[model samples]
Target: MTLSAAGLGSTTQPLSTVYDLAMLDLDGVVYVGRDAVPGAVKALTEARTNGMRLSYVTNNAARTPHEVAEHLRELAMPEVDDGDVVTSAQAVAHLVADAVPTGSPVLLVGGDGLRGPLEERGLRCVTSLADEPVAVVQGFHPDVGWRQLSEASFAIQAGLPWFASNTDLTIPTARGIAPGNGSLVQTIRNATGASPVVAGKPQKALFDETMERVGGRHPLVVGDRLDTDIDGAINAGTDSLAVLTGVSTLQEIIERAPGQRPTFVSADLAGLNESHLEVELDGDRARCGAATAVVRETVVSLETGEPAGTEALRAVVGLAWSVRDRSDASLTVDGTLGA
Candidate 1:
């Protein structure tokens, strides 16, 4: 893969008018824990008025689509509906159903979310290997204990088809980051010495299902994560917007690997309505808007600009990424730009 990180193409029109559909990541892009990210509800409402259909695509399989939509509704997001939400549970359940016969017994190691989808696909959820299960589907649930994992391991050791709702290593909670499904999946993998087919972000199944459900001819993936949301957009051959209201940071963007860079970067969802300025490269200097950044060897210097704003950071990121890409060298921010 050609790792071109700088000088990504520019957009003349606002993204809301350019894309027919917006596949939004729920956790970071829309909300964090139980609260809406600042300005998310308002921005989404305006984007809808601008004629962009928004679909919430999530890797969290603990909650059903209805539950997620209800949470969004509680957050003042009235446009969200059960149908507009797609979960990893639905994707893994579909994967298992297609491989097994209709109404076949399948072992479940997760919660109601995982069971709901499997049952909807006419697959029976069995807990034990003695049930003659043809497959095993595991996800993350607080109630999922060692017993469930042991049973899943037994079934997997027998060569049953293994599937996972999502492999997100860490999940953000009101209490802070906690172990997610990927961390739990490692338990069974260590025990049975087997890996599972994942059906979440960074995988194409969830994106494909979201597109099919929302019917977006031109879809823009809006997310706050680089590894999953942004990389998943690249995997699906779609454009993406990276929001800084979540896990990713300016440092991460400065050294983004191939397929990890987003088409646009913004402080919040309000960027949907604004046009992005292209980064202009002049020799070793990169400029965007009123900000200018110069990269000398592996070091980057922000001479004068809005150090804390998006436009200046965009220019600096362009120069930093370009320098790293050309020489395969690391980038060091000169620390002139204040936080």
Candidate 2:
């Protein structure tokens, strides 16, 4: 399962030459809150300048595509169009619109950002408990209260379908942290003993939508969380790179499942420029700089069930080893490896 540079049709150019597109995670990969990560803008500009197509994918159910683009522009990362952004709210809206009857009344327990998508689909948004809702759609709302949860709980008990933009329990914010949609969804779930359909990262629907929006090419999914970004990449059959600037920690990356492991890992965007790997005809090899051993061991553990002990564990270590080895191998593109 090793992806060689030649197999990717890059023997003369650099490994970056083989990747046609990059799917970037907004919150942690590019910027945190309002401040851009160090060298994030430079890395993005360089990638774009080098001719790589870029798309920003997020699980934030609070922002619309337009709002996301505005945030990116404000952060001075890279100018991205609405078409290049995807949000859980948009995905959930599509799900609701397709499944539920058109113009059905929906009990929205979120903000205007999340409600906008459903409204755009012609769904009636209702806040009153007296209104009969066909479904309960939950998203991020700072003003969430017990009253809203009780209303949603009653709706679910009355046989209304429950849907959540994302089940993320915690959301990153400028004011430390706050409960995510997952927490709110959990309250309702616990109260009504109901389950919610999640429409965010790690869900195949959002990934499919993203791929379709990006024209379905071999793209690299970059993010900070292993559960969401890396898992989404696995579900989408794409490569992923994990950065340490967000929710995922070094220990977590080391313990990720093989299918959920990232193809590349870096401290931040700053080190990504120097990050290089060779995708040979046989397999991929990564160059060791700082976290090479950790990446290698993690990949090995993922590929094979063997522990990260000194002994090389066996099992389906082929793809995992190849991925680990090529993390810094010299890839050949069109008979020439890029400098």
Candidate 3:
């Protein structure tokens, strides 16, 4: 569906009550590294109390659901359990089992994250192509190296169906951003000249997997990154909220491509329980609450009245996005988003 003009959806009711499930992306949303995001725990506790189910979804297939759940529990998110976490590993496992026969041997190139799900799907994990595998599946794991990639390449070259948990080129580590499963997949793709059927975000497999297991009628995808999380939401035809506690900045979001735009933008998790202001189109301008944004020629102007801090932000975003989407104009914004 080509979304509404501004690509932003307003809500009169709190999001926590509007949607039955919130498909959340980890690493940037709930916590940064090992510590919980400042008010994440409190906000989530309130969301859960308001009858919203929180499901942690991640493109990182390096960790198992239990491990992920433990980490969330450690961060004092009492609502997160093993059942509440959805990994790309689980998504790929379902894809693999559907193609290859049950109880078949699938060549594994990652670690327990991928292995556990494959086993749960009634498939066996073999390390080498010499083991007579039916298919090959690759994911992100710290221990994967030349040996694993070599085996995966051999299997793919031998005409086995290939699958990947995700193709994210880079992942944020404790040290910094480093090579991710996408980089490794590129290596194999270059060697074998073949692409794996991906099962992560930007593909509906992961979203389908989560909804199938979680049982939610209305699901809202929540994340920090625009390229992956927001794009994934668009691909699945779901509403998305982009939080600012991670890589994506507010200004970048206002200027992003229409396809990558999110349905909502908030500075923190608390916005999950708050009403999202409406952005109404008014000729060559946009208005939200008491704020208004006007685009004349190449410049986009903002007018913020009293008590319209964030509304001013929504105004500019609506104005800028609609202006760009329709006329292909460039708008430069250099001011506070009013948080």
For residues 1-339, could you state the per-residue lDDT of candidate 1 as single tens digits? Answer: 111237454566677888889999988779989888888988999889889999999999988889999999899884777999999999888888888899899999999988898899999998999999999998778899989999999999999989998888888776777888999999998998999998898898999989777798989898888888988998998988888777777677778875568887777788787666788877689887788889777778787677756667667777777777777778777765535
Name the best candidate (by TM-score).
Answer: 1
- Relative to the true structure, candidate 1 reaches a TM of 0.93
Q: Of models 1 and 2, which has the larger TM-score?
A: 1
Candidate achieving the largest lDDT: 3
lDDT of 3 by residue, 1-339 (tens): 123446777887788999989999987788877888889998899899999999999988988999999999998995677999999999999999999889999999999999999999999999999899999999999899999999999899999999999998877655667888899999999999999999998788899999998889889999888878888999998999888877777778878886678988777787788777778887678887788888777766776542224566667778888888887887776454534
Indicate the worst ten consecutive residues by lDDT in candidate 3: 303-312
> How high is each candidate's TM-score?
0.93, 0.78, 0.91
lDDT of 2 by residue, 188-285 (tens): 88898879888888786777777777764667778888888888878877877677777776556544444556766556654334334332223333
Segments in model 2 whose C-alpha atoms lie over 4 Å from true places: 1-16, 270-275, 278-339
